[model samples]
Target: MNSPTMHLPHDDHDCGWYGALPSPAPAKRLSGQQQADYAVIGAGFAGLAAARRLAEQKPGARIVLIDAQRVGYGASGRNSGFVIDLPHKMALEHPDPAHKQRLLGLNRAAIDQLQGLVQQHQIDCQWSHAGKYQGAVGPRGLAYLEHFERLMTELGEPFRSVEGDELANVIGTRHYSRAVYTPGCYLMQPAALVRGLADSLPKNVELLEQSPILGLKRDSKGQWLLQGSDGQVRTPSLLLGTSIFTQEFGYLRSRLLPVMTFASWTRPLSQAEMVAIGIQPDWGLTPADHAGTTVRMTQDNRLIIRNTYKHVPRYGKSVNEATREEIRAGHRKALLARYPQLAGVPFTHTWGGVYAISRNFTNFFGELETGVYATACDNGVGAAWGTISGALLADLAVGAESRHLQDIQAVTGMPSRNPPEPLLGLGVRTRIRMAAWNSRSEL
Candidate 1:
């Protein structure tokens, strides 16, 4: 059987935020037989967190972490860095008071951990506690915001509702009729943050990049032998943090749905253009409509627009140049709809990132097969959810116990099974199209 691997499209590109940073030293590929006490596949947020926690717990044990690409080249880096501290859209749907509180606490814990790390290590990813705005474009979106306010009120979370001139003051865009300003989300340069985290991993953890795994099986001694393109690793314990590709491991195959989302970043805006745009220097806006576009004005004045979701069952193998161009055109239209003043503002980069969604919108977190543990399917809250889940998974691996771990396990018991293949694909595509249509104004 072919070893599961993550394949990034050759034509996919990153924004200037990533390209402007200095490259890390060249990757050291795995080329020979190696052994480790624990192994982590995928060096994104979750994998990095798992490796770090494991290394800290087992000071003398060898921990191997591998990624198909560079540390920050995947979804971890490609995301529009929003480290949310509250349960946003998905959590709002199933609002069991206790469960929501548990999730909120977990998310805040993740943010605290991340904040401490950034302060201690001085990981300069343009980290900011600038909060975020959930903007509404029409009556439907307004009703959604009203429901969000009710939930927030029940949870006693602080939020400010802004509209008309107040909304313009917050985002400088009159496109939104109203908005809810919540002060808990942190914004950052995603690629830089992931790179810093990877670089700061403990000494005992070995990081191998650009080495995709080809196969994985249990040896006669009950150890896992993971075969890579040019090498193999034998470990008694393994953690699968490989994002949407975790399906390839035969773990959450029936429950994991891979969705690819596109993002476009414009070139830095001139001082005059910034004035003309009439928005805050740096702001992040999530649409009140869950399916709507997400917008961010970077610290450096670049506009980041993310929208257009595709049901990419096989990651990007089926994503052609035409599809990419179509996505770009959609992004441009969305950008224009919100900020027509910045007409003709060219996007410097356009890229696609894969995120896993489950049938129940919960994560898959538990032991899959004997010594193999799987933790993924974050719905859409990748940054905070991935971090906390990884840390808790590490705690589980070492036989440690904590209330946080219990909360996570309780919340993400198991993913519900997905529909069979062709039907699953059809259903997901139809849902996405319908959602995009419903959120056209917000987009």
Candidate 2:
């Protein structure tokens, strides 16, 4: 087949968290011909982890890390910035008990990896171990939280339940009638963290940005050739932590679903507004209802509200103009519902990021071809999953063995196949709409 076309968003809507930070170092765009012992495509959390792990293992091996845009400009940077350790609702309900433990172990490992990097490098991305709140708005939401409490109890995890006046004191919003405070999630500025990860990569790894891979094929010399717009990379081994974009390469195409989640962050609150809202310091909260908004008060005092999921099907693509505006408008409404005191607080940034989810809610891992390996489809937990998966894929690439590697390899399988085109697309869109309606109160 000919080289596939790239459809990544041109705007990415202006991410507030990313925008407020200092500009990243100059990008090193790939040009001419380059060669490496290993090439890991996509420089998000996963790719960064994988590249770092490979560099550590191989010492002086030539490793090339490539991204179409700047290292953190994609979903990794655009996320709501929660490094969640607990299993999401779907993972909590996973049929296999062993699977649940394996998932939790991997997630915690990812968090540990990130924490260690931050401490060792003193990379200041406002990393906080303040945990998170899951707030419920009504009976359905309360029921969900109750189930969550039972799940945690079964797993022997500790959590604090708060409601009424206490919940309001914690989050500065009395909108939620009930909440479960889980202490394992860390909140940070995602863009800064990703940039730091790229900056701190081992000496053997070379980062190439603004270099979109058009195609990849095995050459006559038994090397994989990655054709990009301005250059090419040939490597003996490849790891694709490209997340949702893995579908474009004819890998995981049948089973992966590309969906975009939108977020908006208000400008830093004024002293008067802060006093009016009354939430002290910084905090983060996820919704008890699956479709509810994710809210965060930044270290800088800005409030970020993320809600609305849109199924766009194509990876690296942007939602349409109308859809983008609709999501942003919905964000405003969600914020107003919680903090009407902050009404008219102008949102400094609004953006959308794409994440891939498999039909069965499991991630794609392990080798796809003789020398090509992949890890993608993080479902909703991108930060932790991507990081750990990236590291594991690197180990897998070099024939390294560990319990982490074994746990990852044990779950290797293709994502369940999606129905043909329009049917699949329609189904995904319909499901999102239904979810939104069901979670309207939380939104």
Candidate 3:
């Protein structure tokens, strides 16, 4: 019988954040035969955390973490860089106070753990506790923000309301009529952070990049035989943190939805341009309407505009040039609306990143089968959720127990099943279009 093979998508555009960083060291691809006590596929936040935790738990065990591309070249590194401490859009759907509290704790735990790693390794990812701004431009958005404020109050989370001149002074834009500022969110250079974590993994954990798993099978002893392009790994236990691609591994097929989002970054602004804008040096803003644009001013004075979502059931390996131009044009329009003073400025980089979201906004975290564990579909909050889920997954694999693990289970049980193919695509596209129309003013 032919061996079961997996096909992975190839990304077309380079992430602006990754492109801004210095060139990464050459990748160490998997070659020759290898045996590992544990194997992890995907080197994003979740996989990196899983491998690190497993290595910490089993000092003598060999843990191999593999990625199809470089460590900082995937969805984890392509995110908007917000380590959110509180639930945003999810809170609206799941108003259960207990569930929200548990989620908050889990997210905060992720932040604390990340802070320790950054400090210990001195990772220069511009780790900032500078908080986040949720802004609204239209009456619909204002109503949503008001609802969010109520939820925050019910949760006893402190937040400040800013409007008009106050909001403009802070974010350097008067486009938003009202905003809610919460100090719990942390902002950073996502690419830098992921690369730092990969580089500082434990001594026992082996990180293999550019080593896509091409095939899979079981050995005589029922161990996992993972075949790569140049080599293969046989291991007793396997952990999958491949997100939406977990389907390519023959699991989570219709249970996950791959939504592609696009982002564009401007080259670092000249000092004169910076002075002309007269905005805060560094801050991040997410729209009150979930579908609206996300804006950020980097510490280095570059501007980032992120928005647009499309349901790509087949998964987006590479965005075609036409689609790239369309998305960039949308971003350009948003930037001009918000920071018209910088219309002459051009975007240095534009890229698309795909993240998996479930129908019910829950994550898939559990043992898939005997000797195989998996975590996928982080529901758009991948940074914190992915990190925490990865660590907890490692604990489960090692037969260790903790309250955090239980918390993760209590909150995110499993991804609810999704509608099959054509229907799923049609539904998602319709909803996205409706949302875009509603948030047109915000965009």
Q: Which candidate should be chosen as best, given lDDT against the real structure? A: 3
| Pairwise TM-score winner, candidates 1 and 3 | 3
Mind giving the per-residue lDDT tens digits that candidate 3 earns over 1-443? 12255448566556888887898989999999999999999999999999999999999999999999998888988988899998767754585788888889989999999999999999999899999999999998999899889888788999999898888876777889899999999999999999999999999999999888976678899999998878999999999999988988788777888899989999898888777776876899999988899998889988999999987765564457888899999999999999999888999898888899888777888998888899998888889988999999999999999999998888766778888768888899999999999889889
Model 1 clashing-pair count: 2
Sorting all predicted structures by lDDT, with the top scorer first, yields 3, 2, 1
Q: How many clashing residue pairs, candidate 2? A: 0
The sequence of per-residue lDDT tens digits that candidate 1 reaches over residues 242-262 is 868787766676788888888
What is residue 241's positional error in candidate 1, in angstroms?
A: 0.9
For each of the candidates, give the backbone clash count: 2, 0, 1
Q: After the best TM-score superposition of candidate 1, give how far the Cα of residue 121 lies from its true spot, in angstroms.
A: 0.9
Write model 2 residue lDDT over 90-144, tens digit each, in one string: 8888668887888889999999999999999888899999899998999989999
- The TM-scores of all predictions, comma-separated, are 0.96, 0.97, 0.97
- After superposition, which runs of candidate 2 have C-alpha atoms over 4 Å from their true positions? 1-6, 9-11, 315-318
Error of 2 at 182 (Å): 0.9
lDDT of each: 0.86, 0.87, 0.88
Per-candidate RMSD, Å: 1.7, 1.4, 1.6
